[model samples]
Target chain A: MTAREEILSRIRGALGDTPSRPDVPRTHRQQGVHRPGTPELVRQLIDRLEDYRATVVRVAAEDDDAIGQAIADALTVRGIGQVVAPPGVPRAWTGRLADVVVDEASIDARTLDRIPAVVTGSVVAIAETGTIVLDGATVCGRRAITLVPDTHVCVVRAMHVVQTVPEGLQRVDPRRALTFVSGPSATSDIELDRVEGVHGPRTLIVVVAG
Target chain B: MSTFLGMPGVPVRGPAADTAVGHLTGDRPFPAAARDSLADTQLRRNLAHATSTIRAKRAAVVTEVPDWEALRDAGSAIKADTMARLPELLEQLEANVVARGGTVHWARDAAEANRIVTDLVRATGADEVVKVKSMATQEIGLNEALEAVGVTAHETDLAELIVQLGHDRPSHILVPAIHRGRAEIREIFALEMPGVDPSLTDEPAVLAAAARTHLRQVFLRARVAVSGANFGVAETGTLTVVESEGNGRMCLTLPETLITVMGIEKVVPSWRDLEVFLQLLPRSSTGERMNPYTSTWTGVTPGDGPQEFHLVLLDNGRTRALADDLGRTALHCIRCSACLNVCPVYERTGGHAYGSTYPGPIGAILTPLLTGLTGGDDPNDSLPYASTLCGACYDVCPVKINIPEILVQLRAEHTEAHADRHRLPTAEAAAMKAVAWSMADPARFARAGRAAALARHGIRRGKPLLPLPPPLNGWTASRDAPRPSAESFRDWWARTRGPSS
Candidate 1:
C-alpha cells in the first residue's frame, strides 16, 4: 500500500467507531467592534495604525487634487523622489510627485528593488487589527508591486474602512492573492522588541482619502 | 544531484520517527542539560526579558475580547472536529489541490518528506533556495538534508537567520535564538554572514537593517523556496502563512517555485474557520492584535506569485498520537509557543534540554507519546518527569490543552512501561510500594508512626546526621532534613480518645 493509504488507514483504525462530530458552537463575537455606526471605529483604525508606527493622514475632501497634494506632501517630507504607481489610480496623485516611475510593463524584482516607493489603492482596511488588504486588482497591482519596494503609501477611502476582520473579509476576492498588511514589515524575533522595516516596506503611509 | 536521503518515495517505519521530528537525544538528560543552561547568566537574562515581554503582550490583547473564552472553545472544538474527519478532509484536500494546478505528495515519515523536497529542488536545478521560518521544516531537519545533497537553504526570517548564522539549535519556538543577547547576535552576523556590514551595532533596528540588506539580495536571487503552512483550507486548497516579517512574503512570492510541507492536522474543514485561528494565533504567539502580513494563496495563480506549488502532507507520528484520546490533544497544538513562555520549568531549562525539535511544556509529554516510550532508556522517557505539574501551560494554552494532566498521565505510563525492563526493583517503585502498603492498615500505620518518632534520637543539634545513609542521604544531599516530632499527631489524639469513644 502507498503512504497515503497507510496513513489514512491508520487514522481510520485509530478512530474505531468514529462518533458523529459535535456541532461547532461558533458563538464568538464576529464583528470588529461592539457599537455600530460609531465614529470611534474609524478613530480606532487610525489609533491602531499609529500604534503600529504607520503614518496616517486623513483627507476629508473628495477632490482628486486634494488627495494628490496629501500624497505629495508625504513623499516630500520623506525625500522619496521616485515611486511606482499602478494603473487605475487617480493620475493627479502620481503626477504631483517627482520622478514618478509609472511603467506600462510589469515591474521585475530587480527594477522594483531600485524603486524607493509604491503607491496603490487597497480593497479594504480592518479597523480592529489595523490591517490593509490588497486584492491584486488593477488598482492594487500584483503582490510584487507592494512587497518589493522600501515604502508603501496606500490610499484608503473612508468608505473602504471596515470595523472588523469579518467585515473586511466580506469585500475580499479570494481568487486573487490576498496580502493583509497590519503595518510596515516588522520583527519581534530578536527578544520580542518591535523593529520595523525588514524586507517589505520600511515606511507605510496611509492617506485616508475620501 | 545526489539521492543520499534514501530512495525518493515512501520511507519504511524503522526509526520512522527520527525522520519526522529531528533528533531523539540531547547530549545529556534534562537535569544535566538544564544545569548548564541555568548557569549561563546571559541566557537567563535574555529568556527572562523576552518571555515576560511576550507574556504581558499576550495578556493585554487576550483581555480585549469579551468573547475570548468562547473563541478558545471554538478553536479547540474546530481542531477536534477536524481530527475526527482528518482522513476524509485530507482526501478532499488532495483532490482540490490537484484540481487547482497544484501537486500533492504524501510522506509517511520525515525521510520521505526531505527526499521529496530535495528532488523538487534538483528538478528545478536550483543550487540554493530561500526559506520561511517553519517549525515543520525544523522538525524534519530539512536544511541539513538539503545540504547533504549540496543545496543551500538561506533562512530569511530574522530569528531563523540568527540560528542559521550562529550555527545554533533553536532555543525557543517563535524566537528560535531567544537565548542570545544583541551583542551575541552582532558577533554571529559579523563572523558568519557574508558581506555583512562591518559596523553592526547591538541596537535592534541597526541589526535588523544589516540582516535585511543581506537577505533581500538572497530573496531576489533564489529560484526555489520552502515553507510550512499555518493553516490549509481543504475546501479550496488555500494555504495561509501568518508572519510578522515580509521574509515569508519574499519566499512565498519572489521564488519561481514554492514547496510547502505541512502536517496533516494543519488542515481546517473550511476557510471560515480561520476566523478562530487567525484571532487566536497572533494574540497567543506574539501578543499582537495581528501580525504584519497574512498571505493566502490557492494552488497556483497564473501571472502572480509562484507558478509551481507542491504540498507535501506529512504524518511521521501523528497517526500514533491520534490513536489515543488522552494523548492526541498534544496534536491540536498550533505551534503558538505560548505554553513554553509561561512554563516555569521551561523558563529555566530552555529548548535544547528537551532533546526534540519541539520542546517546553508540549514536548514533555509529546515526545514520549510519539515514540511510544518502548524502552526504559528511551531519551524522551526522562521528559515527562521534567515538569513540576504547574498548570500555567494549560491556563495560557489558547487551545486549552490540559498539559499538566497529560504530563501526569504520561508519567504513570512511563513508570509502568519501564518496570519490566528492570531486573531489580527500582528505588522509585520500591519507595512507592512501601508507602502504599504501610498506609493500607491502621495498626501498621501506628507502628510506622511510632518508629518515625523514635528516629528523632538520631538528630544532633536540631539537624539530621550530615551524611545519614542510603535513602536518608539522598534526601539530605541537596537539603537539610527536618527532625521528626517527639509525638506523632495520631499518638496525641489516640491517648485521649482510645477508651471513651
Candidate 2:
C-alpha cells in the first residue's frame, strides 16, 4: 500500500470504530474590537509596539504628507540614506530619501541585501500582542523585500490596527504569504537572554500614521 | 510489522524490534546517561540559570492574560479534536496544499522521509541548503542524512548554528546552546565561523552580530531552504513558523525551493484556530507577548517567496504513538518546551541526559510513545522513570498533556512489557504479588509483619537508604526506602488498647 493509505488506515485503526470528537470550547478572548483600528485600539497598539523597542510615531489619520515625513525622519535618524519601497507604498514617503529603489522583480536578492532599508505598508496590526501583519500585497510588497534588508520601516495606518489576534486574522488574506512582526528580529537563544536583531532587519521603525 | 489489536501501527507482543525505530531512542538508558551529565558542574550551572530565568519570564507574561486558563483549555481541546480526526484532516491538508501548486509526500517512517528530502535536495542540484530550526527535522536526523549524501545543511537559528558549529548536540529545545556559556559560544564562532573577526567577545549582542555576518551571505546564496511547521492550517493550506529571529523569514522568503518536513500531527483544522495557538505558543515558549517574527505561507507564492513548495508530511513513528488511547495526548505538544523549563529533573541533569532530540518531561513520555519500549535493554524503557512525578510539567503545559499521568501509565506498560518477555516476574512485581498474598488472611498478615520487624535489629528508622542488596537498591536509587518499625501497628494497638474483634 502507499504510505498515505497505510497511515490513514493506521489512524482509523488506532482511533477504533467509534472515536470521540470532543467539543472545542473557545471561551478565550477571541474578539476585543468589532471595528478595525479605532483610536483607542491605535493607542494600545503604539504602547505594545514601543514596549518591544520599536519606534512608533503617530500622524494625523489621513495626512499622507505627514506619513511620508515621519517615515523619512525615522530613516534619517538612523543615518539610513537609501531604502527600497514596494510598489503601492506612497511615493511621497520615499520622495525625501537620498536613494530610493522600487521593490520590483528586477531587484535581485544580492542587490536587495545591499540596500540598507525597506519601507512598506502593512495589512493589519494587532494591539494586544504587539504584532504587525504584512500580506504579500503590492502595498506590503513581496516577502523578500522586507526580509533581505537590514532595516525595516513599516507604515501601519491607524485604521489598520486591530485589538486582538483574531481581529488581525480577520484582516489578513490567508492565501497570500503573511509576515507578522511583533518587533525587530530577535533571539533569546543564548542563555535565554533577549537580544534584538539577528538575520532579519536589526531596526524596525513603525510609522503608525492616522 | 504485524498488527496488534487490529491497529496497523501497533506492534505485536514479544520483543517487537520494529518499534525500536528512529532517533527517538537514546544511546544509553536515561539513568546511566544522567550520571554523566550530573557530574558536569558547568552543565548543571547552565541548566539551572537558563531554566530559572525562563521560568520567571513565563510566569510574568502568563499572569497578564485574564483568560489564560480558558485559552489553555481551548488549546487542549483543539488538539484533541484534531487528533480524533487526524486522517481526515491530513487528507484535507494534502488536498488544499496540492490545489495551491504545492506538492505533498507521505513518509511511513524516518528512512523514507530522509530519502524523500535527500532526493528533493538533489533535484535542486544544490550542494547545501539553509535550514530553519525544526524539532521534526531533528527527530528524524535530517542533517546527518543529508551530510552522508554530500549535502551540507546550514542551521540558521543562532542556537542551532551554535550546536552545529560546536559539533555538539542541542541541550535545550528553545535554546539549543543553553548548556553553553557565552564564553564557549564566542570560542565556537571564532574558530568554526569562517571570516569571523579574531577579537569576538562573549557578549550576547556581539555573538549575535557575528552570527549575522557569518550567515548573511549564505542565506542570500542558498538555492533550497528546509523548515518545520509550527502549525499547518488545513482550511487554507497555510503553514506557520513562529520564530524570534528573521532566519525563518529568510529561508521561507529568499529560496527558490522551500521544503518543510512537518509531522502529520501538526495540521490543525482551520485558519482561525491559529488565533488560539499564536496566543498560547509565544507566551508559553519564549515568555514573550509575541515572538519577534511569525511567518505564514500557503503553498508556492508566485514572485513572493519560494515558487516551488513541498510539504513532506512525516509519520516517522507518530502513528505508533497514536495507537494507544491514553498515550495519544503526547502528540498534542506544540514543541513549546514550557514543560522543560519548569521540570526539576530537567533543570539538574540537562537535555543531553534524556538522549532524544526531545528532552525533559515531554521527551520522557513522547520518545517512548513514538518508539515502543522493548522490555530488555532498550534505553527508552528507562525514560518513563526519568521524572520525579512532579506535576510541574503538566501545570505549565500549554495544551495540558497530563505528563505525570502518562509517565505513571508508561511505567506500568514498561513492567508489562518486561513480564511478557520473561517467565519470572520483575522483582518489584514479585514483591507486590507477595505483599498481596500476605495481606489476604489475618493470621498470615501478622506473621508476615512480625517477620518484617526483624529488620529493626540491624537497620535504624532514620538511616540513609542505599547500599542495600541488588534488587532493593533499585528502589533506593531515587527513593528513601524506610526501615521496618520495631513494633508493628497491630502489636502496638493490641498493647495500647484491644485488637478489634
Per-residue CA lDDT of candidate 1, range A1-210, in tens?
A: 777777776677565555347578898877764443246766888899999999998887657788889898999998988999888777987878878776444667889999989998888888888989998777887788899989999988777777876667667866568999999999997888999889889899998876
The DockQ of predicted model 2 stands at 0.65
Cα shift from native, residue B377, model 1 (Å): 2.0
Q: What 10-residue stretch in candidate 2 chain A is worst by lDDT?
A: A29-38
Model 1 lDDT tens row, B1-501: 111222333222222266234654565667778888889889889888888899999999989977889888998899889887888899988888888799999987888899999999999999999999998888888999999999999999999999999889987889999888899998998899899877788899999999988998898888999999999888878889999889999999988899999998899998788878888999999999999999998888877788899999988777777767767778888989999999998888789888777899988877676676654666677898899897999998988899999989888877777787777666788888888898999888888888999988887765685457687577666775677899877988877678325
Note the residue pairs that clash in candidate 1: A32-A164, B19-B110
CAPRI quality level assigned to candidate 2 from its DockQ score: medium
lDDT of 2 by residue, B167-238 (tens): 999877888889998888999998999999989889999999999999999998999999999999988899
* DockQ for all models: 0.51, 0.65
Cα-based TM-score, every candidate:
0.94, 0.96
Global CA lDDT of candidate 1, please?
0.84
Residue A54 lDDT in model 2? 86
